[model samples]
Target: MHWGYTSIGASTYKGFDVSYTDLIGTFGINFNLFNNDVVRYYSGFRLGLIWRETTPFPAVGGALGFDIKLSKFYSKIQFYLGMRLWTDYREDQKNHFYGDSSGYKRGLITNNALLQENGAIVLSMSW
Candidate 1:
């Protein structure tokens, strides 16, 4: 079990600059390549609750990265880049544009359909 967090000073969302934060939690595995044990690679799926001006929604995706074993204040450090697709992202964002609407415009998913209209690039660090 692992927990994470992130903060963005500025970012581009649909061509506009935005700022936000996230609280993340993940479960996955780490494997040591060639059994060297010095360098380990890891991949996992993640789910984050995005906190932004518009609304809070879940962004879920996977990540791939590695762990470097360093002898210092932080013995193990990880750098990962991930893509999180929002479950409530509308294709046109018209709902956010028009205050509110019915049906899918209001972030609804129907009959086995996944709301995958939006996504986010995630860069994070952990020790």
Candidate 2:
């Protein structure tokens, strides 16, 4: 259990990321929210896969979904649902107890084909 941020360089413009990693027994739960939203209330949550050295940013393992209400100009809400293609990661130090096998590598998998099995839903209403 820990929390912190990383700076790529010494400049006003910087990438920010926060994560929560919990290893309890044989299972774990990881949840993170990225703030790339043009607006403050439009951000989303990435829930799944905890922290892994291979990944530079937190990710949502397994099935994932999110909903966003773009500014107020639009009458419809944007929704998204998808599943992570999984990854194959290996630890530098060989430790058989934890199995160093992964389906994909961190950073290697992004908005590419790995996250392609995704869908979007829109509902419009006038108020």
- Provide the overall lDDT of each model, using Cα atoms, as 2-decimal numbers: 0.48, 0.29
lDDT tens digits, residue span 35-102, model 1: 66545556656665665566675656555555454433544665555554434322333454334544
Worst 10 residues of 1 by lDDT: 1-10
Scanning candidate 2 in windows of ten residues, the lowest lDDT window is: 2-11
Q: Write the per-residue lDDT of candidate 2 for residues 1-127, one digit (tens) a residue.
A: 1122111111121232322232211123324457443211122222333333433222343322322434445434433332222332222212322344353333544523234233334232222
In angstroms, how far off is 53's CA in candidate 2? Answer: 14
Off by over 4 Å in 1: 1-18, 72-127
Please report the TM-score between candidate 2 and the true structure: 0.19
State the local distance difference test value for candidate 1.
Answer: 0.48
